[model samples]
Target chain A: MKKNVFTTVTLLARSAGILLFFLYLGKGIQFISHLPIPGSIFGLLLLFLGLNLRLIPLDYVLPTGSFLLNYITLFFVPVGVGLLQYSDLLSTHWLTIVVSSVISTIATLISVGWLYQRFAK
Target chain B: MIYLYLIATILVFLVSRKLLIPIKSPLANPLLVSILFFIGLFSFTPLIYQDYATANLPFIWLLEPAVVALAIPLFSQIKQIKKQFRAIMISCCFGVVIAISTCLSTALLLTDDKILLLSLLPKSVTSPIAMAIANETGGLASLAAAVVIAVGLLGALGGFSLLNLCKITNPQAQGLAMGCSAHAIGTAKAIEVGNEQGAFSSLALVISGILTAVLAPLFAWLIGIIITI
Candidate 1:
């Protein structure tokens, strides 16, 4: 009976946490729409404020947060698939995208790597 | 209709997680798995991309708060972040400049599409910052999102492999480089390498994001001036 109760509480907490996340997500969207910045960006800022103010404990939300984070890539699947509609755009500009991405990545690696090596001393 | 896409997303996630463990390679990355799944689905189904996107919109909406949640880790490490304040500031500035300049220069020389150029500007930063930069620079947020994911996947798949090739055996160096360059995806790889590396990498990801957000516009302005002159 004790174990079952514990399980129930945990499940309740998880559901509650997810609910709170959605609530905040809604508020975040609303906040962003009125601002000059993007809604999602605003939502992130609101989340930061909530965490910093201790209105929400990381521990309480971590299970849900981590679950979301883990599958972040999956969230982008639809976007990637949407790229199919832009295949002609991609093909025509393939060289530019490929070259820019590769060069920028290498440049980032070198700059950050060098800086870390220097200051990590 | 949208429910079907959500269901598909959940199914893909489950299958990818199971398949990823056995491969132990970035190629088997969950994001890559989902992307491939979506691709196959799109190819096989007659459903238009628009309908699929409309159904998947909620997931996209989640991107903002999820990024903000990254600040949770940053807040947790506040003390350490404070201690390394100067180093972090300087490194962030340098990282941002290099990231923006390289991307812009390459794009200018290689392509003339203003839209694509704008979209690519924020590719190095985390998604939120990338989206902001794209918006400020007159790019589509959705396009920037695509670029950021592509950059992240490239980093996750090839970062460690590249580190090994370069004989960069130091965990701290590897983690910092990966995190700064690759953001979350690289940090994921960093965690697999070790705890210390993961911690440092996570630190780099946050710092780089903050720095990139502040600097992308300034660098773009400078690039614009140089081009005009």
Candidate 2:
């Protein structure tokens, strides 16, 4: 019974944290969507500010946060699978996708690796 | 119908996770496997993306909050992050600029499709930020999301293997390279490698995401692509 209660409370706390985070994100999006900048970026900034201000305790939120991070790719599945709708665009521009992704990723690896070697001492 | 699809997705994920343990190769990633399963399913069935999206919308709504929750980890590492602020900022600026410009130049030289050009701009960033950039830039968010997943898979599958092949032993270097190039999935792999690598990679992911988000638009504007909105 004790273990059950503990698990329930932990689960409740995590769900609450997730809920609050989304509410905050929605408000941030609404505010920044009007501006020239992107709302999600502003939402991230707001999250950063909120954290630095100690408005949200990291310990209480870490479980939910890590949970989300662990399965971040799962969240992208819908959007990714949605690509089927643009099959024609993809087929026509397959080379562009191939070149851009392959080149950019390789470039990123090289540059970041070099910088890390030079400065991360 | 949509409920059945969601159930199928869950089942596929579980099955893939089990199958992956025995194989334990990069190709066995549950995400990639589940996607392939759906791709095959859609190919044979008449199920449209619209129907799948309608079913998947609830799950999709979770992404924004998950991203917001990334602040917790960032907040916990605040002091370490503060001490290395200069290094982080400088590296991020250099990293973001090189990533975007190289991608843009490569895409432009390789193809003239405006939509393809915009889609590739946010490829280095995390998915949510990349999706926003793609949407704002008049590229298909769905396509950008696919590109983001592909980038992540590539980073996870090849990153550690290549690191071993190249004999790059430094945890910091490994973490930063993974996060900078591969984003969250790379960071996940970094964590599996070691603690220090994971911490640094997570830090790099946040900083790199922010930098890419800010720079991609400016780069687009500077290149004379008039903002459609």
Candidate 3:
């Protein structure tokens, strides 16, 4: 029971820390520039640098980070559901989406792959 | 009242996971299945998109933390990434440029609207990052997210065939291709191929995402200049 309680507390604390960091960057980005990239992306870079530079303890964020990553898909469900709102846009642009995604995806794969093989040697 | 949406999402996802266990195909991704399930559920039920949004606000907020949490895998892979740092960086840069430019040029030809261009700008990245970028660029975040999902599904399902058709057999190349193009779903497919492929794909996923996040705004600016000219 003691161990379980400790685990729960740790999870909560770590998760709160991660959330706080994200919010921090979100607000900071708002102040800095109205850039299109989300603050979360900057927050990720910050956390990554912090860990790499040993500014933040790995254990402090590891559990919460892994947990959130594991369920990242769940978090996007709302966005997917937002698809309901764009039925018209989707229908009108379905052909473009299908053809473009396919062409662009293959184009990306070939270009990246060719470059890696060309330069890796 | 709002909790109902959460409960239903979890249940549907679990059911979808169980059903896909035997099929073992990338096309049967739990994310796609769950999203479709929820879309169906909302259609039949009295709940509307706004109702779902208001109720599922917490999950939507979770997207921010989820993006931040991406640092963990990236950090863990730092040592390995450092070993091939130059190669990885070069390939990622090339991939991002190719991916964004192709999408942009294609979309530009297909549509005269700027919002659609914004929506497709971030389609190469993961969904959360894509949605965030889309929203910031004055596009519909929902449209971006949906497009990202479809892109992921398409990559997961068709990636291998494309690779084979191109005669690209190098694991690193294959992984980078998938991760750069498909994002997470393609990473999943790469993991199935081999550990080396998985590692490279994960690295590509992170690098491509970061590169897109950093470079997309600049690309938008350049495109704006060109348009005005």
| lDDT leader | 3
User: What residue runs in model 3 are displaced by over 4 Å at the alpha carbon?
Assistant: B44-46, B108-115, B126-146, B156-175, B183-229
Clashing pairs in 3: none
Ranking by TM-score: 2, 3, 1
True contacts kept of 2: 0.51
- lDDT per residue (tens digit) for residues B1-229 in model 3: 8778778777777788779889856567777788878788778988676767787888877767766666666677677667767887898898999999998887777775677778888887887678777766677787787788778867877787778788888887788888899886676566657656765776787789878988877877766765666
- Evaluate residue A92 in candidate 2 and report its C-alpha lDDT on the 0 to 100 scale: 77
User: How do all models score by TM-score?
Assistant: 0.78, 0.81, 0.81
Q: Give the Å error, residue A49, model 3.
A: 1.3
Can you tell me which runs of candidate 2 are displaced by over 4 Å?
A2-7, A18-26, A33-54, B47-49, B134-145, B184-199, B221-229
Error of 3 at B24 (Å): 2.5
lDDT of each: 0.69, 0.70, 0.76
Question: Which scores better on lDDT, 1 or 2?
Answer: 2
| Chain B only: TM-score of model 2 | 0.78
